[model samples]
Target: MTQISIGVPVFNGAKSLDAVLECLRVQTFTDFEVIISDNGSTDGSKEIAAGFAARDSRFRLVEHAHNIGAKNNFLSLVEEANCDLFIWRADDDLCDPDFLAILKRHFDSNPELALAAPRVKFVHDDGSPNYEEDFQILSDKIRPLRIGDALMGASSSWIFGLWKRDALRHALEITLPTYPYVWGWDPLTLLPPLLDERVETDANALLIKKSISTARYRWQVPAREMWEMRRAFSRTCFIAFRQRDWTLAERVIVGVYVFRFANLRVYRFWKTVRAQMREWLGLKRRQRRSVEG
Candidate 1:
């Protein structure tokens, strides 16, 4: 078995799949298998993945006849992975050649480490630099502080980090019940490992992410959907909080953190609502002026 399994869950990712695959092919660390899970894409994604698998012994393609939801596609990769170390690679993200090697070294040096992620550089679809983010979480031994730090500012990029397979599976089991919705899934899945105090980050190892204007998309979602997302986020935090064995003080601390996190989401939801209301009013005014003219 390979030392690591890199799972790529893709759907209509033809535009960037080739480049992503090339990045993996040239990685300085060579003992890893690439499992490409294609979600019935008609946009030539299947052929691109198949071609890579045909040429590289380390690459394998798994086909789904029908389009499974994105969440299911991600879970399928985890189920298919064979290595003790696993990571989910987005079809559009690029990693430094030494990314795997650096993270693997961290795990090797610290057997207790459950997850290791590098800092992330965000780029536009056209390959222009956007910004860089440090994968920040309090590395404190105190579980509440770690959970609070993660809830406040953990980068979603951590979801792509190299993880001990068992830690990842355990995290997913705790977080998946509330994960059917798209928003806020990453932070919830990341909390369990952070609470375990075994997650680490290296700024030198880099992941270049292709930004897709996700912030704008989130704002555009209907207000009702945003409320549903907020509910899911709250439920996830509650479930995660209950799953742990905590002292009374730890429970109270976690409760405070969860309160803050929920309030933050609620604030964002209201902001989105106001933005949409203004947009709708502007559109109405434009229509009235056009009619009068």
Candidate 2:
């Protein structure tokens, strides 16, 4: 059995898919499989994936007849994995050749580690720098983190990190139900801590996230549709807080964090309402002026 399985979920990602696969081809570690899930792309993504699969036995492609959305596509890849360790690789991201090799060593040494991730940086399509770094600088050496620290450090950036397959599957099962079609699954990262799986971090190892470009735009969900997602994130936080056995101090800290999230949501909702009212009043005034003219 392969030691690691990397799931690549793509939807019309022919542009950068080749580079993504090429990085894997040159990986220092060989015992890995790349599972690509195509979410009903009309572009040349099929040909690109098929070509790679034909060229390399390690690369396998699964095509969907219709668009199943990103969340399901990601889940499908996880379901396809048959390895001890797994990671979700976005089509636009890049990893150093030693990325898997380094992370694998950490997992091999630490049996309790549920997740392991390297440092991350965000770059543009042209390789120009965008965000300074993807994750907070927690430490320089590999170290185990408390559940709370790990949960706070997990910026959905860890979603792409190496994970124990069974542990990850279990976490997803508990957390996925909390989220709907498309919104904040940020709380899902808290699953490791919730499931009592330890998390490890390596500030030196690197994963490069290519920031979204004009050619790679994401589908924007409307504001009205996002309330459920926001609530889901808060719900996930509460789930983690309740599931884990923490000290009274930790509970208080987590409680404050959740309360802050609720206040922020309320503030955003109020702002949205005020903006809508202004727009409606302006429209009414324009209609009156037109009638008088």
Candidate 3:
């Protein structure tokens, strides 16, 4: 068995999968396997993945006949990995050769760590690291407000992180089938780790990555998909609260709706238009801008 499994879940990713595969092929840490889960990709991803599998024993392919939902497809991918440590990477991203080498050593040194995440460096279209501003953004959120205080707020977390195999299984059990979250995987993955284990963050810019295509859970994804996600998000929050978490859960529920206030589609634009106009006119002090810009 490999020392770790890097779960790469892809969808119509032929355009960028090869770059990622090439990066993996040259990894200094060779004792790991790549679980390439293809979710009904109509593109050339199958052929690209097949080429890699033919040459490398570490590369394995799991094919889904139809576009199995992203969350379930992801679950299926992770379930097939044979290692205790699970590292998630988008198909279009690149990883530093030392990414796993450094992370695995930490696991070897401190066996109790259930999860860990490293500082992610956002890259421009040309692939240069956006080091100047990205780190600042990460530094701001690494210490988010206590979950309860942020209630009526929003709940979210970074995904390119390492997870202990067992921690993932526990989170899966809490999933609800409300038409696609399959168990609040997004919010579940985001918040549950904060409860069971302290997720470690590193300054090492090991996980080099970018999204080559729009995927559910990103801002540009469909609103229905997002609202569907919020259902799971809210449900997870309730579980977190009833399970005796004093602050994080309730606050997270509130946060998910509040942050997702517009996305929830609970309030009509015209109905809220008057209210929003009043707030806008009354408040000259507060403003929100697009963060990615």
Q: With candidate 2 superimposed using the best TM-score fit, by how many Å does residue 113's alpha carbon deviate from the native?
A: 1.0
| Tens-digit lDDT string for candidate 2 (63-165) | 8988877778888888899898999998888889999999898888998777886788888778988874445434443222344344444555777888898
Quote the lDDT for 183 in model 2. 39
lDDT, each prediction: 0.81, 0.70, 0.61
TM-score of candidate 3 relative to the true fold? 0.69
Best by lDDT: 1
TM-score of each: 0.86, 0.82, 0.69
Candidate ranking under TM-score, highest first, comes to: 1, 2, 3
Residue pairs clashing, model 3: 147-248, 148-247, 148-248, 151-251, 152-254, 153-254, 153-255, 154-255, 175-183, 176-183
Top candidate when judged by TM-score against the true structure: 1
Q: Where in model 2 is the C-alpha error above 4 Å?
A: 134-149, 194-197, 213-223, 258-293
Query: Model 3 — which ten-residue stretch has the worst lDDT?
Result: 284-293
